[model samples]
Target: MGYYQIDCFKIHLTILRILGVWPTENPSPCYIYLSGLFVFIFTVLYVVIYTMNFYFLPQQLEIFAEELIFYFTNVGALSKALAFIFLRDKVKKMLEMLESDMFQSDNPEEIKLIQKAKEKSSFYWKITAGLSVSANTVNVFLPFVVHVVFNVKLEFPVCRYSFIPEQYEAIFLYPAYLYQSIGITSHMLYNVNIDTFLLGVMFLAMAQLDILDRKLRKVTDVCVHTNAPSGSIDKMIDDENAVAEIIKCIKHYDAVSEYCKLIQEAFSEILFVLFSSGSCKICMCLFRFTMPAETKYFVFLTLYTVVMTLQVMVPCWFGSRLIEKSSQITFSVYDCDWTPRCRRFKSNLRLLVERANRPITIRGGKMFLLSLATFTAIMNSSYSFFTLLRHMQSR
Candidate 1:
């Protein structure tokens, strides 16, 4: 629980467990069954409701745009669940890495850096979760509130269906409403938790790299080593402590690299869904903004667009930071008192720098690098799509 010790991640894992995607270590058969069933419900809901709705709905851009806002929930939820199950081996390795001793730190500075990273990751997920909850709340309750206050007929969240006979329509409408609400809410959390977990992994890797950079500098830091041999400063690199510390730094950096590769493997397909579907979701969300609508829908769109943007932005952010942290490792090795160190130490450091020179890169579907530039590109594509849709709507 090295990283799970943080409360945010603790809560995140708990919610994930409830959603059935993360069954925990050596879960009971009952737990697995229940989890599987819970996940299945959303998959079924997506197949039954969204597809049916799409098939039956008119070919109007405005109607499709309105419906698209909710489309991400079920598909994303099911895809993430499948990703976890399909890549359970990778997920297991990730859990092992998260709990491994390499991530543990006794130094206050290193611990602080780790904590700060977790805190930032926590803020990102929490905001996303909160927005998702808020949006769903408005959608579910708006009908009841309007019905009671304004004597208006209660309407379902999205496309109303003929699931019940006309005579029983009034009786079954409320139940249908509750059912859809549950599906959407569960799906929303499912998507949010997976995202938070992935972003958390990236931030954690960056923190470990930063810690390694700090250690690399201190390994050759001669001024701090009072026991340096007299009259030969470069010989300080020959000290056993310096040798041991450098070896530790090497192992630590290697562990971080391994952790990153496994993470990229586990989430490659899921990230593809997130970025590709996420861009269209954002584009439609913005496009939804231009249409005339009720205040509640407008509010939901505002928050949904923010969540969509964050879904794309946060990954690119953590991805870029990960690249930067790894890239700067070489500088960290050279910026220290390494100029006075011996040749063997310099050679070992050079190997480490060479490895660092490649840097860690996490991509979406192995197609686009997850960096801010990529994020900007996705946003530009989205804006262009929005522009195209707006033109169609005007005609």
Candidate 2:
């Protein structure tokens, strides 16, 4: 049971709950009520601020550019929130399936394979989580630090709108700052948790593929050496056992296939939104970085660009690995000693090869394939946009 445990994902869920993006598993009445109330309040404030920024902000290029960045930041948050709220049940079901499949194995070899996969997955999750937290912390607190050190009064408006009344500015300033801070941070957490969880699932899929690859090779070896045994009876028994092992491998492969499909279904839209917003964010951040700006904002923009780039890269990296691992299944089947297997076993092998040839991929909204190639394309497009913006700014 201890070996079957998945603790890293649990820690992620805890962070989600703490950030108010996810409700408890069995929330009490008061907890549910308060959580609902808070979400509603947060949503309302977010909409008001977003609407104000979009419609009422001045036409100055610098202000408008800053507002656009803010708009997309909130857009990322809102999309993440909506995805979690709508897709949480699907995500939960996926997790349940993952846990059941990954932890139920009793074979020592299989267990070791599973443990290795889990370790790799945990490493990826921790690194991504740490980077996300560090980025958010700096982005959130840099203004205050700059204000203190430079002796400049920093205006921390959720969105820059011209509507705040002078008479109420003094009274509402602190409260407004507090409200915006909470709203933004919660939204940021939603982004972090959803992405991290999605990555966790991807990593697990990779682990499953690794195990499947090993099992596949072992089955092939057993089949290939069927003639090594001296007696006819021994050969027959070995053949029977090899067939059974192949059947088991087929079932394992099927389970992994289904798990990959579930992940695709659950996170496709979320990944789509992330890619779309991320591209825009990168372009804008890069543009802002190239323009003349204060030291504080320049640093913020640089960090923002890095964070956005990582957000896109994480999925692409994992998704590409998934594709690579899955594609190996066909080759693993071919590498086995299939020459000695019976008709039925060969038939199953052929089917496995056919299926594996199709390649398991994580698509963004079922549109763009999430792969290293896609990541490269995104980077190229962002740079192109940045170049175009620079040209216009120069003019």
Candidate 3:
């Protein structure tokens, strides 16, 4: 019986693998899945939230905005505090090293210092990497929690009678609202996490730059002062076999920094979009309470189109600019002077630049997908809203 049970287990494992039910070795595929989920959630949330603000308590939009602000601010503070505790010492050391004299050779003493700095920097960023993972995990689960907790409802009866009201068609809206609220909340939280991760990545690149700059300055000083044999710096510089490596490192630093800046710009732009949307929601609420129902829905539809378009188009626009910058960098590197000794280095630099400029196919590709999703969701939701309003009008 035991032998049979073991054989059954092996069979089950084989079946799972054959069916592609086993966990993937690569995490990129996993992240791509998450990103898809994220985009879907955001689209749904925009529809739900905007519709609720328009169709329901349009006057309470300001209050909702305030609540959102509090939630995002708290999350940001928590993430920043966690990052500081993990990275304080490493950040201080990197800053100190950057401030120090640049002619430090790869002597035993300098090597020890670089090793320590690198270790500390790595430790700090590892914390951020963990937080990035954690934040998304929390976002994934929070919607389920909120759905259970809020028991949010969007449908309430409006008086349908001319003399005495009859029940108009009941539209169930709370589930949609719940999903929207959760999606927006998750997005805000995710932005905070992205900002923290960008900071950590930038610091890591800075640490690498500091170490390399110090080593290069030391080599230049030595070459000036002493008639050293060829490949002298190769012995002294850690992994300094060719100029290609240095260019590669520099290119990597540029990539990291550029990504960080893009995140920053994207964050700010998204926030502006959210703020404007929120404000419009508040205005719609005020108008609805005081104005007619039909008029309120009209304004809501207009605002929805504007907000959704901005969200989709702004990112696509920025991503296009990034592709342009990356392309320019390719030519910039190719134009650099190459010494005979730096031939391998030049080739490597060219390779790095080419990779950076390769049209940003994968990451930038998502923008188009995002645009499609946004457009479809907005058009569909608007149609549904208008259809319902028309039905109410006919009755």
Number of the top-ranking candidate, with lDDT as the measure? 1
1-395 in candidate 2: lDDT tens per residue?
A: 44253565777788776655578688888877776677767765676667775666676777777777767767777777767767778777777777775335766776677677667667776776677667656655776678779966667645754577769876776677667767777776777677777777777777778778888887855544445654577666667777888888878888887878888788778778888878888888877776678897887777778878888997898788889999989888776777776677788888788888988887888887989899888889888988998888889
Every model's TM-score = 0.88, 0.89, 0.32
Candidate scoring better on TM-score of 2 and 3:
2
Evaluated against the true structure, the overall lDDT of model 2 is 0.75
Clashing pairs in 3: 45-180, 58-285, 59-285, 161-165, 244-345
Off by over 4 Å in 3: 1-247, 250-293, 339-341, 363-395
Give the alpha-carbon lDDT of every model. 0.78, 0.75, 0.40
Question: Which tens-of-lDDT digit does each residue in 55-81 have in candidate 3?
Answer: 333354333432332233333333333
C-alpha root-mean-square deviation, each candidate? 3.1, 3.0, 16.1
Candidate 1 matches the true fold with a TM-score of: 0.88
